[model samples]
Target chain A: MKKDKLVIGGHEFQSRFILGSGKFSLEMTNAVIQNGGVEMATLALRRANVGGEGNILDYMPENITLLPNTSGARTAEEAVRIARLARELGCGDFVKIEVIHDSKYLMPDNYETIKATEILAKEGFIVMPYMYPDLNVARSLESAGAAAIMPLGAPIGSNRGLLTKDFIKMLIDEIDLPIIVDAGIGRPSQACEAMELGVDAVMANTAVATAKDVPLMATAFRLAIEAGRSAYLAGLGRVLESKGEASSPLTGFLQD
Target chain B: METKMDHMVYLDYMEQVDSDIMERVLDTVEQYDYNTYIVEDVKAALCKDKLDIDDFGALLSPAAMPFLEEMAQRAQKETRAHFGNAVSLFTPLYIANYCENNCIYCGFNCKNKIHRGKLSMEEMEKELQSISKTGLRDILLLTGESRHQSDVKYIGEAVKLATKYFALVGIEIYPLNTDEYAFLHECGADYVCVYQETYNTDKYEEMHLSGPKRIYPYRFYAQERALKGGMRGVAFGALLGLGDFRKDAFATGLHAFYVQRKYPQGEISFSPPRLRPFINNAEENPKDVHETQLLQVMLAYRLFMPYAGITISTRERAGFRDNVIGMCATRISAGVKVSVGGHEEEAKGDEQFEISDDRSVAEVLSSIESLGLQPVFLDYIRV
Candidate 1:
């Protein structure tokens, strides 16, 4: 387990946890990455300001992978435009496509996601798309050259853990690519349970960023991911309807 | 047509103001006693982990008053959770005040014998430089509802120059058709704000008198058309004193809620601007909405739609603006000027209304920080 690595898009990372930098205090950006032992993270592409708060990249450590998300995109065209602009920022080839149109539900549009992924992946971009869980869509995305399948655990920022557990599990069972459970993961235990269910990794922000102490929560999540992966590797025992026989049974008449 | 009003009345019951715009909708909305919403079904709704529109009437009722502080606390917590400790800042630089309407209670009424002027293209550019130099990136380009001078093309040119210095540009001007809004967007405007003024159409028609703005449905649908035209966001509001403030707040919230459902992709914000006094205005005695009531309405807005932006401007004083910045509202307009060519040069023309808070952007920033909050001057990026 110590030697294990989570691989995606031909890149290998020892930590399965990926930090989302939205809604987090700028000062905590470095801590969330360094102390949490996170090897990758996501940030949105905003217009470069000459001064003021500066860039999210300014706070990032030198050696971690950057997965810039197209968060404000509502259509494939918009998402593609963001992806191209992000590439121009020299953040490497990785892009996280989040094409969401339903503001009421805040659900990702899988059709547009696939369209954007197809266009982006062909243009030498490593595409990892966030989507609602669907096997057909996963297959479509895989054919479209997406590097990984990221299915939401629930709505974004909901903190309602694992409402889509079975759907995520279904993807893990059928989808040939790595199934990363993203969004709505509220607690550390929820992350542990996700790993125990054979998920490749869990990606979340609100679960830690909204906590009373962000860096502490980030540490808890790090340990939880490690524990879940170890338990999965150790092979948990099966459940039974009835209890097993005692070491000294009542059938021993003298003892009874 | 003039009467010394003692208390506000139902639009149907009023004989002085024109009741045509409100007649059909009044019967439907008047049935509910929203005054008791707090103690009735709304309390239960607010107690729940999540609230729906069914709880709207209860929150607006008189019963909701005792729970104002509680609602404010919740509003503060959720707003922080959603938008963070920052308040996105912008300042309106009025480019024109050449309105052509004969409203009874307005500073810019056609008969009011005041200066009518629009900023020349060069004047607008100079104003942009003046505003951009303030280090405020979000700019709102405003115009009088004039078709001839501040037409779509005129506003369009202003937007092009504004894109040079500002990352986010919004407009609060005459309502236009869908394609015209799209043209404005293509020309570099990112958002549009149109105030319905009063949801009670009768009061609105009586107030507006005669103009293209008299068409109620066109103004009502302007935000929707802006979204269709590909603007990233649109803001909604109503002038608070024209009708029952409670009822106006309720209608404004419901309108924004409906718009959110319709254009799920567009950002929604609500601004309930109070009626203020202007020099030479004939009707000076507009109804007063206490600061407490304004706070209550702001809390209700946060509870009903947690994600939408609540904006407070210079119409309210510095103290009220400071009190609400971190507590409920997520957006504020600082260093506002309400006259043509007000920013760049001598502001000699008649201002639409006198600004109560004359604080600069630095003043607003320091005040926001004194409350342990970060003042965010920018949120959206053009890339």
Candidate 2:
């Protein structure tokens, strides 16, 4: 069998699960990453600062790729500067452009995200823009050279799974890039459902971080995502339009 | 109804108040067009698994009234998803009923000829002892909007007294400065409840008439100040009948939404108290807010902010409280007495307003258990 891989910006990843490190404690970061079988992890640059509580980089394993996010950037210029700073700080060229100005909902500004994606992609960065699931905006981001478009399943940290299901489905059907669902995925079943819907990858943070056991929840997400990806690959069964179909041949029954 | 000197005081307080939040709320209220929503829009709003602000508006509109059953089911599912079957119980102890405001609707209005009183520290402790004996760990301390009679020092002392008996002490008194709220929080107040009586400033001005409460912006910012004071939680409410019920309800949800966003760690709750008849206004009922409408508002709030704590107070009837608790409400006020210092002895003053469900704590607990829900007294403990 041919091995499947999630390709973003010409980089291959065996793990389709992208772990968010924003909410996890530094002590648990490595365990959660290893338990979840994560090959890629996103971190805020501030958490990696040398003088902070403790540098998150020290806990990261050698095989993991760090996808630094521009979390505090409210405009395209600010996002670009943060991306450059992340690169200068020895983090890789991979950047998640999160240009958010709406303080209430923490909603991403697709316009600013597109601008930042263009600027960062031009500077030879693997740019991924977290966006609202709007088709036209997704197209613009693709045109602006975003490697993968990460659309929110719900508001950030809402633990609401696939509230934007219909729009995200439209993106999956139309957008010609890896459609990685991000944010608000609370339970393993939700992540599995997203994977079954054929999303290329899933990014989760709060759901696992706030769990009763962080590492256990991380493993649950990993298994669910893998099961979902396998199921998607296997091709899900069809549903009846009206009535139930018998599994054991109704006409072949002895009573019949 | 107000004197020239009262107008002078109102103007003086107005000068000292910040109006940025009020302006934002009023702008939202003025621009909200509930009438523009159609049945299709409401249907579309209800179809989504999770709701946004526009969907919230549609659910609160008249177009959504016919789909009340559907809304209730969705609200129930959201409630069960977020809060499970655990309903927290708390009782409000009115520590004082003295007011410097001339708000015409309230029984405790200074101009009203109602008996006024403030609880002494010993009296407050006795009341707290009586309440604490009921196995109720959460207690909210309320006072009429009067700083002169019930100052910050007196409220702080009452809070300090409450902390000794109750595990969680909350304040629903007059709006205080950030420093004053800090003082009360330092005295062990865990939460603050401030109802911006009405968000419509014009209606607010006409209704408030006079007093420091007439300073709209100061009261609007009370919850933010309370959060800044290091309180763990803050509750938002609006007297439902004071203005347009739907818009007022929307503004209440939006206010809490913004505050919760600014302080992500802060706990937010909602208490949608209708305009019950007070002493001066015995004939008054909620202008347009009936039971179904109030339920709709609460369901909308639950769908909008699933994590928020919605307190169904004893202001509603017993049956309504029971029905809504399983549907959307996460908290209830049991064994309530609005009069100042009434738990351990005879009433010391007139009650703040009438209460409909006068069920005792044990009865309320039994009722909650019968509905297959757990009645929690204290969900969080202060170290």
> What tens digits encode model 2's per-residue C-alpha lDDT throughout B88-204?
788999988989888878888889888888888878888999998888878999999888889888898988888887768999998877888889989999899999878877788
Candidate 2: DockQ?
A: 0.03
lDDT per residue for candidate 1 within A148-214, as digits (tens), equals 9999988777778888888888888887777788888889999999888888888978778777788
Candidate 1: where is the Cα deviation over 4 Å? A47-54, A240-256, B1-28, B36-38, B281-288, B366-375, B381-383
Fill in the DockQ of model 1.
Answer: 0.38
Give the clashing pairs for model 1.
B34-B61, B35-B61, B35-B62, B37-B58, B37-B61
Model 2 per-residue lDDT at B375? 69
Task: Tell me each candidate's TM-score.
Answer: 0.89, 0.63
> Which ten residues in a row are the worst by lDDT in model 1 chain B?
B6-15
Sliding window of 10 residues with minimal summed lDDT for model 2 chain A: A46-55
Superposed Cα deviation of residue A71, candidate 2 (Å): 25
DockQ of each: 0.38, 0.03
